[model samples]
Target: MAHRTRPLNLAVPALAVLLLALVLAPLAAVGWRGAGLSLGPADWSAVRFSVTQALLSSLFSTLLAIPVARALARRRFPGRGLLITLMGAPFLLPAVVAVLGLLAIFGRSGLLNSALQALSLPPISIYGLHGVVLAHIFLNLPLATRMILQGWLAIPAERIRLAQSLGFGPAETFRHLEAPMLREVLPGVALVIMVVCLTSFAVVITLGGGPKATTIELAIYQAVRFEFDLGRAAALAGVQVAVGAVAALAAWTFARPAGFGAGLDRGLPLSAPGGWRRGADSVALLAATLFLTLPLIAVFLRGLPGLADLPASVLPAASRSVLVALTSAALTTGIALTLALAAASRPRPLIEAAATLPLATSGLVLGTGLFLLIQPFTTPMTLALPITILVNCALSLPYLYRILLPETRALHADYGRLADSLSLTGWPRLRWLVLPRLARPLGFGAGVAAALSMGDLGVIALFAGESQATLPLVVAQLTGAYRMEAAASAALILVTLSFALFWACDAGGRRAAA
Candidate 1:
């Protein structure tokens, strides 16, 4: 029995080593290449701007999410479930598509400016620091709302009932019951958003370029692409890595669990206060819905007309993106499953770290390091798609690992002994026990990885040549060329494909589970 398990144990550690190498090798390359380099004023400016925008974006996102989350938790209305489902969309949305949507409403020739002009008011700009922060808020606000809503939902119904029985009004209830939850939840929410925004590449690249708006991610791109300064790019990559690490560390340290004990599995409604509170909740719901959905609607409307006139480059690029997405999804799901299974047998810190350390690294930083590592060997363009797939796997692995770990652990606990006693091992054991039980999460995780890879514009931008461009890269190129209609059409196609992949995989998982 021990000999039978020996092979499995050895395989897990070998894979863990590979995963760690993939993440750490790039950092080592960056350090080796930029060992003696110092940041210039502009690089420092980028750092400052990056930190400032992330802080502002996280602050605004979390603060604004409170009312909206509270409203969703306390109020039950038509389309409420649908609205909650839609909230997940923006988080998974392709940044390039989201930018186009935002531009449709906020750009100089966009709806808001047009309306301002009609009203004899000065038009506003969406090409600066504010625009970057606005886009981050747009992307992360839903996530914060969702997290805070979970906190609200987790509160024991008995506490709310007790408050009501004691004749406690809204303020007193909030003080006694809700405030503590917020205290426990908001810090973690804010820090997660902060970490996400800290590695923002697309938002800053699209809406922010000037020194005042540049982030370290964008600066790395400029150093590599424009200045052809590998040293500067590597140095900037190190800074981005450090910032991400610090932010991740801060989140882990400060974001403690809510510590609220377990509750009975009974259904009870939260207190839905009447009068002005009802009106406020209604407004909050409406505002959040509009804020989220309007930009997407704008993208659809703008893209419809241009679909017939799309560039010839669009189809090939779309195909390439699909290929990359599918390949990345399959690879990520397989790797995550292997790691998850290993962890289930016996939890190991190294395995967990290997799965998650990528969270503290950005796509562009990985691209930069890979670019440096590959330059000495061959032209990066020749291997763009493969590198993109690899980076996508690394970037998307953590999400899949988190999704599959618990299920894998449960499967092991429930069936491990039985399988071992019956001499179940390797292929036979996986076929009968592991695959059947883990199929749902595996499917969903593959879907998430697929959607994320399809939408990713980061690494591909650094390595892709004209002939090798993916759909997101093509969209960015079209936009850069001021071909708004073409860009819109391409963006629409990208969004459709991304969502379709996600839905098919997710629905397939559900069907298989059923």
Candidate 2:
């Protein structure tokens, strides 16, 4: 057996316990407060709406992504790589920024409405269930496409060559090769998309427009903040957790490592770019391009004019956001690394579940619980920044853990015996063997955490006073106050900062790896 040092042995459960306390304490508080309350009919309405929208969003995003992924995979065009990179932007963009962008294109007096007016058609309202689903598709379609594209690209070139030699057409090729990959990939994609849509807070609240389109997450917010109904909020949070857990487990079951094979340093050729294939690919690419690019373009154009007239609160909020992001990044990276290392060494199911607990706990629930826990001791506002930092760290851990676990396991698998034989342990082992090997994932995970924390509005919305708002919450407040132009400007700044943080950290990772 490998020698276990006291510090290394103690760190695992310590970190695990810390994570459990951060997540579950708030949940327990909420449950204890609302123990006797049953869910009302309106709560049930929110539940139905939440599930229905999430299902529709996941279904449409996954279904639409297939042809788009196929087009991008088979037919290389001018700027194809750039388009692929831009597909990730929606994910990084603050949800408020994306909402602003979407509204700029789809809003009543926006470009689409103007076009409809010119064409003698009635302007359609960007509200209700369909609007919410559309927003979700906008956000998640790229995610689905990327997952599917990775799967498509993973089909070995030799297999493609075999199919070509056998005179297989597109139909035959898809039937034998692509169809199976899709079958393997789609469930995970759909389930992940569903999990995302299930949370459905920022986008749903923005586009949902009224009670008619409320999601459970949105309802939880309303119950706590608007109605001061802790019982209802607690009940709704419980529902969110229950649904989220099932979806998360299903997603985990279907999840496979996206096998993105290497060989891109050389010019590799593909087998599916002929006559009708060319035309179909062009249409798919163009449609996706127009759909994704136009909103961002609108945001840039509109926000440009508003930048000079931006409110006084924006800069302070931006600063606060940066602080929270950095703190959350450090905390998330540390905790995720610690927990991942422990899990890698031991492979305990309990540790793994604790690592993923945040996936089942929403920001609203955490915030509510934290608020309740702290309210009696001191004002929630007094500890707002600390609480936000902790909540953001907790929320980001699951993703960081995902990124770190595989790398940690690979490190252990490759170096455990070698390191043990050398009598290398503790700081020496970590510095010489683990740290250098882990720099890339650590940097990437930290980048993701920072960017996500920068954009997170949910828990902060629950805890922040007027003066304590983060950039996303500030943007929401601006929008609610009907300052659309100023809101756009703030959102653009938020989006820029989020992407910049991600790029810097990600670039640092790449440089360190190199």
Candidate 3:
């Protein structure tokens, strides 16, 4: 039996080591390359802006989501399930696409501005610090709402019954049952959004620029692309790594589990007060739905006309993106599954850390470090796609690992003894036991990874030469050149491809599981 398991044991650690190397090696290169460099005033400004915007974005996203989530938790309106599903779309929506959507509604000549102009009011600018915050909120509010709603759902129905038995009013109910969940969940949600915004590149680059609005990620890009300052870029990357690590650690430390005991799986609903509260909840739902969906509708509507006149570069760029997305999805799924399976058998901090450490590093930071590491030997452009693939895998691995770990652990707990008794080792075990059991999460994770890669505009921008551009890059290029119609067209294609890849992988997994 030991002989049969020896290969599995060895493979787990070997894979862990490779993952650690992938994450740490580039960081080491960054540190070594920027050993003596000091950040200038501009770099300091970038750091400040990054931290400030991230905090503000997180605060607003969490605060705004509370009412929306509470409404969803208690309200059983029609289309409620569909609305919940819609929340996930913005999270998967490409940063470039979301920015374009925002521009369509809020830009100088966009719908809102047009209305203002018709009333003879001054037009608003969707560029600078405020724009950055608005865009972040737009992208992250849904995520915050979803997380909080899950917290609301996880509160055992018995608790709601107890509160109702006591004749608790809405305020009393919130004071006792709901607020505690928010206390437990909000910190984590805010921190997650903060970390996400801290590492934001595409959004900041598109909507927020200049010295006042630039984030560390943007400054790193400027250092590499515009200034050709590798040392400065490395220094900025190191700062980013520090900030990300600190935020991640804070999230882990602060996010305590709610000690709400379990209840029988009853389908009791929370107290949904009527009168003004009902009206308010309806308003919240309506506002949230519009805020989330309008940009997507605008993207479709604007892009519809330009579809027949897409730039020649869009098709080829999209093909490159699909290739990258598929490849990244495969690699991420394989690595995430291995790590999850290994961690399920025992507590492997090294494996777990390797799986998550990428969260503490942005794509541009990884790209910068990789560029520095690779430049001494060859041009970074020569290996752009491969590096992008690797970075996407690293970035996407954490999500898949998180998704798979719980299921993997549950599987092991339920079937490990039986599998061992039967000597279900090697390929047969995986084929008959593991794969069959874990197909759904594996599919969903792969879909997420694919969609994310499809919409990625980060590392590729740093490394891609003209010929190697992806769809997101193509869209950004078109937007940059003031080709709004073409950019919208390419962005629409990018969104379609991303969602399709996600659906295909996810559906395939669901079918296999069935």
Candidate 4:
């Protein structure tokens, strides 16, 4: 007991402390400055706008996610596996990539507009409140779908079979059985989306042409940093953080990192309903597919034509992104493994909670903290590549912890007694037993970290000087400079590279687990 339990307790907390310190830096900055800070009406307005847009985005995305998740859970179809994988893509898809893809399709010169011009109809506007919501749904719909399907997985097969035998129709089963699971899981999906929207910068920046549409995050950048109104920027940060914290708390409350799904029997055909329900599910799923995929399709179509116009700058920018991704992956994996190992035992509600804090605190926020932290010790913070990597490490930790903690908990719960009985402990137990058992999830954790790092725009945006620019940052720069074609090409390459990297890492982990 002493040998096995003591090391586990000591290590987990130590690792957790390191991870927590990094996440706390942002809150610490604002609080360290003091509570007497005042936000003007403008700052309050940004908060109100943030909440409104995020609510709209979350409500619409979740409502849309339901039918698709049900179809994926309730119906058998070809290409289902591929669709589920794509549903998880936004978790790694950089905000910049989605923004560029959206602009090509929805922008005035974009496909929809071109079609509108040909038919002499009023073109759809892609800037303002509508654009922010559009981009949010584009990123979140698939995520919410995946989460709901996972909830569907929680319904016992026997429970499902019994429900059918009792003559409960599909509608009844969904209402009684699936509805509860949705109730349970909806908070998690909504909370995740809300925090994401609160921290929104890139979405608002690219799409926000007018003052009315600005988010607190974008407003902060304009007011304090770019506009050089340090007082207003500081004021906005206080309001933003307060609002973000409230949303963060809500997210934490609804945080079922491990969620409940209704029921699914893999590859088994679900009982079908006639007419309206079936027709509705099919139609809704189709709309979601098109809504999510069309812009991405446009990225390829519009960007490919301009591939020849890809800046000579791309080769170097892409090169730097790859280096950053590789380094961030390795570093993120190391931190994940260490903290995961530390949290392997203990009741880690706090550490687990801390893991997700970075989700609320944007890369821009963290980068700002890191910039302030390092400024006394360094020149233009972007020049310090090592600090940028550290920011990436912090940014990627939440996904890594989420991926690793579940498996870690299971590993310890199931294996701890066995190892303690054997008097096996520390590296011996971990190497010989626990590590072997958890290889697949740990690798998945690593892959997730790497993929997210590859796509991250937050820290990189702040630290990416021309000399140190990452792919996502370079893509943003191109779009801003109106080198739209080059931006699109870079967006495609960035997305492809991130997916490939995740796949390779995850495959290796799975192979190792096997």
Candidate 5:
């Protein structure tokens, strides 16, 4: 399924040069000390701690999601679409926002604690390993559920109908039909969770009390941002990259193409269960929804009044955020599309990997790395707008790829042969055969990139000054200044903008996909 009519050209190489310039900002800043560092016992201990936590979190998140997903997939109910949308909402949130929401639900003065005090029970701590795991689960459970639900959706309905027609009992049907689908999806779920948890920074930092809960990304952050120990940060980052590369590659093996199931080949009708199975499923669904949503509700309640008194600075901050998101979205999409186009039918894993390299390191690590790399050269604040935009673009490539690759593959699959046969290659082919076909995915990716960059707090963290601050950066500043109301107001605004951007882009994509 490869197109060979046209020879490779300069798009990716040229864009890669630009991408490399931006992506390598940190490595260039920290280059002198790169070779001087080595992984020692302390680094190994941090790695051990991070790996264990990620494994436990991944296992727990995936296992817990199974029942939730199974319940959603197997049962019928009112408001199911709403439930599904809520489940998918976490994927759209910034990790910091989700962490905050989790804190509101699970922290000392949280709902759980209020319930405990009514019974006069001892208060539980919401810091350290337990809290980190809880936050990750809260954010990722829905993701795992969606992935598994996709698997459930993949089960050809005809197969299920055949079993029913053969008078197979419910238990027998599940064993023969459902079990295989779950097994096929399990590794992908685990691997994705492991990769995500490995890169945990915001959650670990917010929830981590001290050494006992330390993750490697947090270690890298402290080493650079707090301690200014470029040497230690480099060592830990290197270790993280090495370990993460292995895990990512393993996950890549299990990673199948997205959009596996269409509502074609239908047979069995999907519906809800009854009796004890129904009650148990209903209860699980209710608790999962509550745990997933209550913290956001708390944030809403806390911020409702505060929205009126939002700092005069917030509007300007918001203005800056939108401008930055626009620039970044354009840049990210341009870079992503160029790479995807240039790489349309070539062997370019290195180029692909380089474009996506930003995801391996946490934003804290990236910010610090870029800070060190760019400091001897220039103040990041001098180019704060562009630098933050680039970082967000780089960080969001994997998501962009989630859209681009599929559309590209499908376009190539359907018409590439004919186009090549007719010798309609290069821009002509791209303009007609490719772009029109991929409009939906590219637009969708752009929308996600825009929405995600809108809520970013990472690059701005390194570059923030009074003269320049995005809304999330402003929110962080408000939190640092102990203006809880202002921070809440900022968070609310940030969420709204984030949601709107995602919705618009996704809507456009859907229209295009249609």
Candidate 6:
């Protein structure tokens, strides 16, 4: 027992210490500085606005997902797989690019407005609370649909077979089967979307249009950049974390593993509902596809024309972003593997929590702490890319850990005794057994980390000088300057690079596994 556990004892403690210094210490800095901070009316307003929008965004996203998810589950259309794949595209999408795409369709001279004008009706605005909610819905609806669809898919064929044999109609099947599944799924979906919208900065900053639409994250940025008020920024960070913790706890309490039963390859053959029900499904599917696909098409169309006039800065920024993303992918994968291995060897709550703690800490808040921490020793601008790399590593850890943990446990459970009996331990066991078994998930986690880091705007915005900026930051700068053509071109480049990296890594993993 002593020999078997020795490595884990050392590795787990070391990981915990690293997380403390790198992740927790910085958050503590925020809490420490904001200890005496007090909120004014404006600060309170930001809080109210942040909570209100998040609630509305999550509510709408989850409610809208029910019908869409149900339609996708039962109906096997020609392009069904492609549409499902596209659902995940929004996750890898850079926020700035999404904003540009949305504007092309919803802006004053955009499709809807033009149609309204042609009909002699007043063109509506896309720059207030509704605008923010609209953007959130566009972004999160896919996520909610995917989650609910996963739940639908997990329902056993036997239960479905029973329902069909009992001559249950659509209403009865829904009441008995689908509604229960949704009840199990929607809470977690809402919680996830709520947390995402809670810390949303780029979307609100761009679409918010003014102070009245500001979220807590935007308020923090304002305090730091305009007021130079660390106290106010820290105070807002505190509120953000408090709100995130409450939501997270609620999710943890209510959340169950969505996995119910393994799919048996053959689907449950149920009778299709006809008439208006079918039409409603068709409308839902068509509207969703057009809404999501149009913006991407616009980005490509708008960007193609501007590529010839691309700026010189785009290349350098792209290079820097690639470098940071690669480095962060390596760092995050390494840390997540180490922590996952340690926990798999022997579970420790503190070590596990430390890995996930960053999820609750906003990226801008982490950048702010790092800025304060390193400002005394050297120029923050000089260390901008490195700091960004580190923050990305911290932010990506939780996802990587989630991917690795289950795989690690399964590997150990299956092979631990056998490996020990064969006297295969330490590096050889991991190299031969664990690594081979885990390559696919590891590669997937690395890809996700890479893509996420490639498009991250939070840390870079805080630390970037005029000369040092990532691709996302560069795109945002162009948009701020109203250089729409140049911005669209840069966004295309950003999206391409992000997707390419993810594809290469994910495909490589599949090849290795095969």
lDDT of 5 by residue, 1-514 (tens): 1354324454456667766666566655444456676766766778988998888888899999988888988876799989998887877776666766765667776778888989999988888888888888987899999998888777767676777788776577678877877767888888888988898766776777366778887777667657777788776766677677788888778867333354457635434557887888888899899888787877777777888777888999899999988788888887777677656666587667766776555555566667676677886678777778767887887678656865666677778779868888767887877767887787778888888888776657656777788887777667546566566767788888888887887788678657
lDDT (tens digit, per residue) of candidate 2 on 1-514: 2456776677777778888998999998888877778987778888999999999999999999998999988876789899899788777778888888888998976899999999999999888898888889999999999988988878777667778899988889888878887888999999999999998688877888565788888988888778978778877787788888899899989988534344334323457657988888888888998988888888888888999988999999999999999899998898888888878866787688788888887887888888778878897887888889998898898999999999999888998879888888878888887778998999889999999999998888877887888999999888777788898899889888998899888888778777
Residue pairs in collision within model 4? 12-342, 151-260, 151-261, 151-262, 152-261, 152-262, 152-263, 154-261, 155-262
TM for every model, in the order presented, reads 0.98, 0.93, 0.98, 0.89, 0.86, 0.95
- The residue pairs found clashing in candidate 2 are none
- Model 1: what TM-score? 0.98
Task: Kindly indicate the candidate among 3 and 4 with the higher TM-score.
Answer: 3
Question: Model 1 segments beyond 4 Å from truth?
Answer: 1-3
lDDT (Cα, tens digit) per residue for candidate 4, span 145-184: 9887877766777677777889998778878777877888
Candidate 3, residues 1-514, lDDT tens digits: the string is 8998899899888998898888899999888888889999989999999999999999999999998998999999789999999989987899999999999999877899999999999999989989999999999999999999888988998898889999999999999998888888899999989989999989998988898999999998989998899999998899899999999899888766677877788656798899999999999999999898888888899999999988999999999999999999999999999889889978998898899888889899989999999998999999999999999999999999999999999999999999999999888999999999999999999999999999998999999988999999999989878788889999999999999999999999999999
Residue pairs in clash, model 3 = none
Give the Å shift of residue 487 in candidate 3: 0.7
Candidates' C-alpha lDDT:
0.91, 0.85, 0.92, 0.76, 0.75, 0.85
RMSD for each model, in Å, please? 1.2, 2.8, 1.2, 3.2, 4.0, 2.2
CA deviation > 4 Å runs, candidate 5: 1-8, 17-32, 36-45, 256-264, 267-273, 345-351, 354-359, 412-437, 477-483, 508-514
The Cα error of candidate 4 at residue 398, in Å, is: 2.3
Count clashing residue pairs per candidate: 0, 0, 0, 9, 2, 0
Error of 4 at 190 (Å): 2.1
Model 6 residue 293 CA deviation in Å:
1.0
lDDT value, candidate 6, whole model: 0.85
Residue 493, candidate 6: C-alpha displacement in angstroms = 0.3
State the weakest 10-residue window (summed lDDT) of model 2: 260-269
Best lDDT goes to which candidate? Answer: 3
